[model samples]
Target: MPPAEKTAWDLARAATHANLPLLGTPMSQVVDRLLSARIRQNAFKVRPATRAGVMVSGGGYQGKTETVCEIAAVFEDSWRELHGSHPETVPGSRDLWAPVAYVQTPVTAKPKSTCKAILDFYGAPTKGMDLPELIRQVAASLNDHGTKVLVLDDITRLRMHRADDQDTLDLIRAFMSMHVTLVLVGVDIPGSGLLREGRGRGGKSVNGWEPTQTERRFDLVELDRFRYDTDEQITAWTTHLAGIENALRLLDARPGMLTEGRMPEYLFARTNGVVGLLERLIEDGSTEAIVTGTERLTEPLLDSLPLTLADSVGRDVAAGEVPALPAASRQPGTRPGRRRNTSFDDRGSAASTA
Candidate 1:
């Protein structure tokens, strides 16, 4: 084979292998065991209206994006892994055989956060020239496929960084009406009046919040914070977190500085166990380390991380910033912030978080 051809083949093979068992999507054991079955069931039950949803609630980090992307990659790459790779030139229409997964994250920094804004993403017919039409075009175009997974990241963005359980729930229901497999990620605790909607208009079954169709074709998967004290699990979710940062850093740029021979122990120590914060911390750490020589990741460098991270970490751990946190728990440079999510150290996996 030509050298370039050989390289492409090798790269494709590597991509296929890394996604085996698809480690990215955070799934409950029940969902994991029945993904294929559930997909098939929904495929048959709802042609224009299938609906399965998962709501992962935790601090802003915890591998949520990693988890979701992995699942998307799984659906995207499964074909090549199962069938031999065709030339990249194959038209996405004629040669495309794998299930196409459409991703629509309507959560943006825009000021309009209304049902019209969201329904637009769902592809509902919109005649007016506005955000709603853009969303509608996106939703319809993406959902046109036979089998697809639509992921809306940070759905809570609609409520301005506040958790609106009703908005979340309503959006999920709306997406269900569209017959799409959905995954929604956001923080816990409702910041909007969405919770009021979920309570149902009195005397209605909570689960009765189903589609108006003849059948129910979806399941619920809830992602929770890793329980720290499970009998089988350890309390130091920090260790697991340390490994995550170390791996990302090692795989990321500046490999030698952070991983060279050892691990990012400080990376783990500082962020505790929040994946979002840990990622930001590591990213900030790597950027600084790369530019600075990183003699060793120190308290001073960590303190200089971006404001988003600083604010995020601060909100999690400070009860009033009483005593300065010990090195093991404190991210450097900054004063004590808010208390963090309790760490989970047991042999606990994401599945255990439920």
Candidate 2:
């Protein structure tokens, strides 16, 4: 191919792989159904009462944030469609009419900073405001914007030992009373001190706060990595891979490039069933395939790529646990060659290897 044509083709392939759609898995489906129902119910309620929220907890790279955000975006789209024109702007004023507000909790979150994050989402000024004032403004903004769902990702960042974090947790609970369905996404929330009761002086509860309130107010759900032990799980995993394979745009790609033979098992071993890691591996492998003129995914090609930090840790944890691929599935003379370091090589040498 000509130089210009090759560059264009390479760019197009990169874009296609980068924007691959989120494949539906059993966990995402369940989260959608549950979160959708809760949001719908909260939106319809006219009476003043605390809305029950959902807490999506899981390990890193389990797609917790992506899944919840997709559901929230879908809800917002349908809501605007149902409300007809001028859905983004209020009828008589320039106020924003947002049905969903998504924000991330600050890494070193305190009660004041947490409230500031919410205010920042609405483009509201929080300067010179104290904690109480910040809280009042946040509530007002939620009402003014007509927000029905508020998503706070990375909720476990709040360390409950500090008084500020304790108050932040309380502030989050207070937001539930504002009639917005709260969707808290975090890693291992149950293990986080957010749910544990604080010990008070003389063994009494601090300020008579009820720790079970969190458990009762929010429906905690977990998103786990895909498992291969059961037949149903195997089907789900392979189906997911097939969806990805179908979306790929390589010139020489063949059907079952990811799902047939030992590829599925090999991929499972590499990613440990984490969707994010699997996508990374596929994307990097595909880019290498295009650069090297192979134009198709293969075991050796994927194996040549390096693992992310998360994947490396997961591999260490699952060492000797993942089942080994059968001997018959291995190709007789195929092995992954070492990736050549071309950063220090001249253009001619790099082109020669390519």
TM-score of each: 0.50, 0.82
Q: Pick the candidate with the highest TM-score.
A: 2
In model 1, the worst 10-residue window by lDDT is: 317-326
Candidate 1 lDDT by residue in tens digits, 1-354:
897985675456434323323122223333344444444345446356446655443445555445655555655575356545533333455433324443333433242344344445444454564655654554555444333556655544444233453344444556566655565554442332132343333221454553322113333344443433432223234344434334442222443444323233444345543445555565556556545655245556776764253444422232111112224444432222334344553656566555
List pairs with backbone clashes in candidate 2. none
lDDT of 2 at 248: 95
Per residue, candidate 2 scores C-alpha lDDT tens digits across 55-150 of 888777778888999999999999888897444355577788889999988877888999999999999999999988999999989988889999
Instruction: Name the top lDDT candidate.
Output: 2
lDDT of 2: 0.80
TM-score of candidate 1 to 2 decimals: 0.50
- Candidate 2 error regions (>4 Å): 85-92, 197-211, 309-354
